[model samples]
Target: MTESPLTIPIYDGSLVSVRSTGSSMTKAQLTTGLARRKAEPEPKWKSGELPSKYQCPSCSNYLRFPVQFEDCGHYVCSSCLPDIMRVASRCPTCQVPISKDKLVNDKTLQKDIQSLEVYCTNKDKGCDWDGTLRDFPVHFETCGFISVDCLNGCGAKFEKRFMNKHQKDDCPKRTVSCEFCKTSIIFEDEIPHLNVCTEFKIPCPNQCSTEEYPRGKMQDHLENDCTKQESPCPFNECGCEYRGHRPDIEKHMKEAPGIHLNMAGKTIALQKKLLQLYEERSNEQKNWIEILARKVNGLEKNYGAQYIWKIDHYSERLQEARSNKKTTLFSPPFSTSRHGYRLALSICLCGDGKAKGKNVSLFICICRGDYDSLLTWPFSHRVTFTLLDQCEDPDNRRHITYAVKPNVCKENRPFLGRPITDRNASFGAQKFTDLDAMSTLEYIKDDTIYIKVEIDNEEMVPI
Candidate 1:
């Protein structure tokens, strides 16, 4: 006779047969048993004690499936008999030879064991289940206190009663689709995904009349479409200070032409005044530079006692004098000796006093000198003036020359004495040369005239 497989009741009330091998259950059977029991609450013995007759002889545990040996009339738990038979082919208690055909189901012992009362293993965690062993497995499968993994594979464990709630409301791996973009994402990542959703609507931050726009189009609206944005007047650089909304500014330009014109005119006037001030300052700086250059030139010519005065823009100077813009021009100062009297030459281009309009007038002025105290008063020095000719042949050139000796008398003291001011009054020829003589000669060439002034050092009076 073939040995019968031990059968156990599962959650669905279907019987699963457990076939044993030499010393263990088959892997597939072991796995199925573990999986079924993994979903159930663990059981606890609630009855005072289990009777020894219902316990397995090999394992000493309460019998799950009791089996009898015909040869020895001995009983053992079906769960433990495979291990016992693998060691020896005999009843573990009576030493009688045993075989697969000699084993039979002990239904009487099983009935007695099933009647034992037990409590739910989760009783310590607030479960109050207490029932006969026959009902324990079924109740455990449906127990609200049983802990199980989330069905969504989110790796969270909670009571079976809360499984539905966690999967529906709180599981991080639960699939959710965005309401605006309709993109699918996990529940926990929904908020971050919405932050970049292109289709999401947002109100304009500028608080313009437009209510809202798609997030991706909001910047374009603010820059190009908003009429309520403030802008400066188109004529702002012309001194118009008006600033307003786009529509209001358009209206302002159309209504305020006279005001803008006045502003522009005033701006032009202010610029002209600033230009005039700049020119005056420039002229003053030029004068100071000329003075400094003259000082440096005087030092270079200390022992020479002669100066070549170059008059440039001859035609311009003549026209200015004729127009009364300027009448006289002075040469830079010179000295009689290295430490002697300082003097300067002056010319009236259009003539002066008795020579007016007929000839050019020339004069000499006594300028204050550093060594004046060591020189005699009523300055008596023989001075000479020469106007250069531009003729190529020096032999044929006729350079106009004139000499003068200052009269040492009280009447001419102001012109001959040591200067008490920047210079004593100029005194010299009223008609140095006629205008017609100058025009006929090479005295003026390339719009330039050169005049030479020299002090006769041999005749210079000393203290």
Candidate 2:
């Protein structure tokens, strides 16, 4: 009903017979020239020339076949389809969405499109991909600059060609953590994530269990909801086993003699024995001084007046030494009534950490039950201590910690060690912070209670 899109041939009378462009020409002319033919027939005036076989717009293959498109007369026949559409489903000639109906059954187009060189759509955007129109759309989507993952850090790949979306986000190569906490998160965060996943719990301080949970629920788990609870008894081997809540054993130990008596402040009688030992040591020192004076006097009388006068002459010096030498004794103001629940004990001792015998001052801080009365050396002698059968692995063993040093411990430089003890010992951070409950932890590996020692630097001293 309308004019043909192509201009009519202009001719002069003098022998001018011309062949028309038929509205389509050099593929380049498909660009600028198409504008001049503004009135070209809708059915494509003389049906533009078919795609060549070499360029094979039909099958996108060199082999000729009856594939073609009605819109643009470009497509692959059913037989040539799989090879031409390798990675793309768009038409080879028209560059439209591939569909079963778009396929043309004209071998002429298959052989004709071969002569045309199709530029990939991405070529305008810097992609230099070149292929027959059939593979051009596919090539454009998979261009190297299309932003692919570098895996380790750079690069691109044909992602849509594969069923799986991608190993990574950008180009399928970066490293990423699991969005589900427990699922395998290949390279990048997944599209969506579930925070409440129970399998992906966090690491807990107790080192017991890990599970994924909300931050609020995490707090509840750490405080009280933990599924597992464990507490070991301090007495490792003596079989004075006790575990569980503090209130339970605190009441039980009050009645159990073997466990309780060994613990301090429970018995009225044991307290009395400690006071007696203090007195006995005092008496021994006094007796030794009198015996020494008597022997010196006897020697003076028997040896002769010279020796006796010599002793007599040195009597002034002897008096001075006696006056200066202070005798050591155990002393505490006697209070018949025991201090209730106060397990604090203080003591002074001469420690021998070095051969020269460095005189060092240190005090032990512990609890009443840290030491056993049955031990006799310290608990009964000092004010208080923590008792145990073993130092390590307290659940199965017994160990002890003395809150105070005994007066009689001479040159005994005790240390805080892995085994028996280490002189220059340090408690674990937890033990260090808890000054009060450290003795109870000695029920595990507690700090050491240092005893003072006396040393002589005479060996290195300059006269």
Candidate 3:
């Protein structure tokens, strides 16, 4: 069967077109009009079926809005009339020539067709309206079972009766007002707007006596108005330990002046004592640092078995020794090997023992070392000492040299044994070099003397 276009008014007061088939309507046909309104089922005729005379000849469907041909009294549905006139200019069944003026609306046949009783289109959907075809269109328009699109543009369809409820309560596009801020907004944006609303009331963050305040004023209230926030006492720097709410703390300050004064006095006394202790500790640390620095310097100097001692300010040292101010001057320490015995050279500028005021005294001392436990006890290495001539010409130089070997016996254990203290007692010649010999040659050139000492590694005792 051919389709017929039907125009209907929707709930939104707008007209939309829908296509109707002969007997039963489809969901697609209904939804295309933006209204899911079905067309009525076939009408119930007294004879059980529509008569053939009232059916269109071209499409074979019952004639709707039937038009009659004046020549043969033949009729076709108005929707199909245009096609017949355009194609053949004659009645489709009789072949009689027909024109637009001769084809007229058959009011009598229309009334007959309208008087046929039919069930409402929404009968399957629980609609009970049953009436003549003439009253069907009016009943369908107001049918509560018919689904229509929401007028709010929310893209929802339901019974025409529920449209009002959907728009007022469920449609996202419906207008709404914020309860707290009293601002108008669409239901779709209501949640997002409420989240950022400045006038929204929030509980006090500090948990003060005040129940709540607007979010916009919360910061100001916390900063200047909260009574439960804890603050330090006014005399906190004077060792006052009290902390309380502003009002309680103010009361404390007014009642505790004598206690605050006592606390101030004790705080000053404690500060003075702390300062004295700090000074003492600082001095001790400084001394320890100086000792560590000297040890580091000694380690740097004693990298090998040989050491070249440069004695500057020789005159001043000699004068100090002669006046009995300082008799001994110690050289930085030296090592027998990279990780072997630690030793140092000491010199008495004026002389000592039998050579007092006659010759300079020189001695060797064994110092405690990190590798002492790994070395052979009672030192046995031979040592050689040389006093550089400091001459401008190397060939013309007369350098004084001496060699010594430790006794390596129990009697010499005090001087040669593994050192128990920072350094063992000194041992060597008391009359090393005479004062007269120093005055001759270039031994004391530029008031600076260079002394070289070498520990013999050739016969070094293996650990």
Candidate 4:
């Protein structure tokens, strides 16, 4: 073959014969040929860079293998074909009228354009894929994007992508059970159906909830959250499950408690068999209270007088000793007295009748001074000071005071006066002068009272 195309020897592991032929060129020759082809001038095509990187304005997507109108410079991504055919059937850039079939399709160019597509902008939203311009719209509609579901108690999930906007508007998964009625509905429908459910459980009419509520706990269940519920009698604590209604509750009180009192109505009865039994108990309590009270006209006439007697028998003895003059230290014979301080006095009135008129006026005069009620008040004894009768005689002037003194002796902290001041004056200001009988009782006095304590010291303006 014409000198065998001038064979040359090459080393490719072993010696091999290489030849240059018109059909089979040498490596350098093939490379030189390619270079020459690249450097050669290519005839200018009618559309330079035709069907390249044009993007659709409507979709904001890269146009692969752009389709051009026959008469216009306007180009569009092939991916937006169906959309562009509808309203904008003309070339967008050149404003030329177009028919759907007039646009060109370049399959070879489209393949090249396809290689240029990239990952979707929404890839981070739980999508994991890439696509070409012509195929990306379909992929986006199906891509699973994780988003919060509108349903109550529904956990977060990757929902179907296409319905994102639609699910937000008409999603059935966004429903919740109502607290009042326990009915299921969309959260937005809650306000509408709040009063709709007929079988909804609500609080009972008579009482508060106790236990296993909305079943038996009614309005009479004692307005408390932690109240002991109406449970089976603890006669046997093995969870006696016999829960009873509130009205008949007393029948199930703990087996036996020594003291029993029943309130049938206005009368509180200390019930027992014998009238003497009632008398004995009341007398015992009466003795306990009289320990502090000045023995006066029929004091032991109220309830629980016997219980007080048992509490303060010794105090009663000391009081009786002082009264009988049997104790030598308590009352000194012919004791001489000298006043060391001045006593302050003032009068105020509080009346339920609210009358400033003397008829309904509550008259109060307090002998205020250095000597304490501890020493002076007991002289009146553990007693209540209350209005007994209004003095009608203008001459007597002093409001008539009567009281069932120490009437609340059963309660150690019984009220002793109306609006009692929680203060005691104990400063030693004035020095002693008199040592015997001529010493007058010195008292410091004030007459004004305040409606509220926060106001600055009030000036007593004369009327």
Candidate 5:
């Protein structure tokens, strides 16, 4: 987009023609217009030339609004007369004593000075303007070569041709807007203004939507104005889903007491039933885990305890299992301690995709151990599984990690001991890393790879 030029309007509207550069009159035409009516002697002086009598003795310039000395009748330009007295009380040319009181307006000389034609002071700079002294001021106003100070106060000067470019692209004083607050400020001050502008946008604290509101008014809006904000029912916990502006919701609760009480009663009843079901499921999972723990404990005593396990030649094993030719491969049972939880890792070559297996699924499971009731019912451990690369230190590691989901409530959980999730949820490549990506994983070495499970007591694994 092109920027408009900065033009100061000419005070004398008649000067508008100063902008035109085209010539309608030729030199010959102009000469004929000023020619004598009949053959006559050539004059000693041209129209614009000042006769010697009209020159200022002090300044040696064409006399303007000449002031005559009453005693000597000598004319001096009004401007030079002032300085002439400063240098000496006598007239510069005649050496006659002169003073301001003896000076009087010389109308004849003034008229002559005004009629003299002169070239514009800017003509050398490419302006072809020509006019009498009386019209010089008007022509100068619109001269293209005249320089102007920057309108934006940037301490720069520009000619008409470059004025718009400087103001639009280079002036530091130009106006700009702050990105965060949308406030207008000078270009140089934009960054600093944004740093302190209080109007920057912020999201509603109630999370009603992604739309943002101005930071300055957010608190008041959230406290008394937001519509999506929720408030407790007058009859607390009435299972009401009706949320609205604070004032409207409050009015509803007060006017609808009877309806609210009925809702409150039903909500309480449902909550109680939910608690009962949760207790029943919790007891069931506790008993089941206890049984498995006992069996695991007896087996461990017979076979030395192991806390880490490995599966070798993974690709081959997956292919075999997928053929319905033994799908489940079990890891040697392991425990963190004799009395701690007994767990095992399990894998299936045929994925549940039922495509007849193109993937692998892994799981962590609970095994019956000796310390059943005496130990923690729901195991809480951070499990990290590493698929070890056959290569050296840095290049040989790929991790598949999961935090064992606690039996928060047996009734609600998908299965026990974190149920190892589904093929899509827990250990499947689709869940941890895509199967195709796993094929390129650095950890798979030779046809064999090792898996390690470590427990971090300090980290609480999130579901």
Candidate 6:
């Protein structure tokens, strides 16, 4: 072997005392010796021959950390020394008498064995790595030519380079499951098969105990087959508090008619009286709201009313709304004074009357405030709704203006007003704007839309 010249540093300074330095010294010695030997040029090899001199005489394998007998210079591998001593109290190579107590470590031979350049075992299999015998373990760990078994224990081996691909795409025994439908499948063809796994389990939206019901049958099962579902009784108007599975309730009703009839008569009379009270309260609330609204409007006309209303994530709000045919949202009530009459802006999607579904209906309605007792009676205002244009273009900004007539008719006013009248009223455009108009105008951006409603100072006119 061609060797690199060894360089040693000489210390002229006195050594300082240390509590622990044995580990550092041993590491430094190993590192320096290995580096010197690794710098040597590789040796040429003849067929089936090596330059290792410390070979075991018994099996003829290369000796590592050879042990020498103290009495003689003959050396043998420490691994085989035990077996040799058991057979006879002699060295296998020299037949010299030996014992465990008489054997000493042969450091010189260990250095030679560590310096011998060896080819990787996979060199014949296209690996070209060359390193000292001491480094063979590390080289073998990351060698590309080295074979690895399937992680799933499929008994198939692949080169380290192709092992990942084999497990993810080629290995038939690899365990995999669909992401969307969660059906177990083999890795091979898992992607294509997942797109058509029709029988995958999905949750019943009605939250039935059958958690893994088939996806395609969910609607039908919830509507007709689910036994745990609750429904109103057939004798609903008879003040029955029982809500349970429909079939059992129907059976109970069919068996007892006289009892149910008597219950129904008393139930109707009580319901009528309750309804009448609700109507009366509702009327009082309407009158209170009307009085408060008129007071706020009158104050706004006297002192300028400036308010900005913002509704964000307009699209998400629409999607979350439970009503498929109609839905309405109301703004927080605002007043012209600290405790003056209050009014709120309302928008009904899918409309309420003739303009239903196709248009966005806007309204300004009365809200009862604390200062209603000190306010006026009749409520009226010219309300204007502005659909803000989020885009750079000015043409998209559209305004819907309405002229609201004052409730001078006594029957048309609410009972809560100072001069209490028996009615409820609001002012707005039934078809303020169409859905198509809002979309084409690009009124909503980033899933958000803005609406600006203000009381117009102009005098009210007939509709």
| Top-lDDT structure, candidate number | 3
Candidate 3: give the clashing pairs: none
> What TM-score goes with each of the models?
0.39, 0.20, 0.38, 0.24, 0.31, 0.34
lDDT of every model, 2 decimals: 0.76, 0.36, 0.77, 0.36, 0.59, 0.62
Candidate 3 residue spans exceeding 4 A from truth: 1-50, 57-62, 88-90, 93-97, 206-210, 227-463
Candidate 6 C-alpha lDDT tens digits along 1-463 = 1111221111122121122211222212211222233333232232356644656675465654466677776766544554566567687767888655555555567777777778877777788888787787687788887788888777898888788888887888787887756777777668567556666567766566756766667767876767666777667667666677757767777877888888888988998999999999999999999999999767656553434567776776565443653377777877644544577777776565777767888776667666666755565555567777777767755554444544557665652243322223455778888777767656777777777766644453311
lDDT of 2 by residue, 1-463 (tens): 1111232121121121112223422211111111223222111111233335343454233333344545564543333354344446666666776554344444344435443455543344465655554454356556553444434433444433332344434434445666445465434344433344544546665555555555446667754545443343444233556764344545555667576445544344565887799789879988998998889755433231110000122224223433544211122212111221112212212221231112212233223332223222222223322333334564665433333323434334232111132122211111211222323433322223322211111121111
- In model 5, which regions exceed 4 Å deviation? 1-53, 70-73, 99-104, 142-144, 160-165, 196-463
Tens digits of per-residue lDDT, candidate 1, 205-282, equal: 768865878878887886677787777897798777888887898899999989988888988898899999999999
In candidate 5, residue 340 scores what lDDT?
59
Which candidate, 1 or 6, would have the higher TM-score against the true structure? 1
The root-mean-square deviation over C-alpha atoms between each candidate and the true structure, in angstroms, is 35.5, 31.6, 29.7, 29.8, 27.4, 26.3
Stretches of model 4 off by over 4 angstroms after superposition: 1-52, 56-61, 69-74, 77-103, 124-127, 146-173, 177-463
Which is better, 1 or 2, measured by lDDT?
A: 1
Candidate 2 RMSD to the real structure: 31.6
Residue-level lDDT tens digits of model 3 in 227-318: 87787897899988899888998899999999999998998999999999999999999999999998975664445878889999999999
Candidate 5 per-residue C-alpha lDDT over 126-180 given as tens digits, one digit per residue, 9 for 90 to 100: 7677767767757777777778899988999877567878888889999877877
lDDT for residue 433 in candidate 4, whole number 0-100: 16
What TM-score does structure 4 among the candidates reach? 0.24
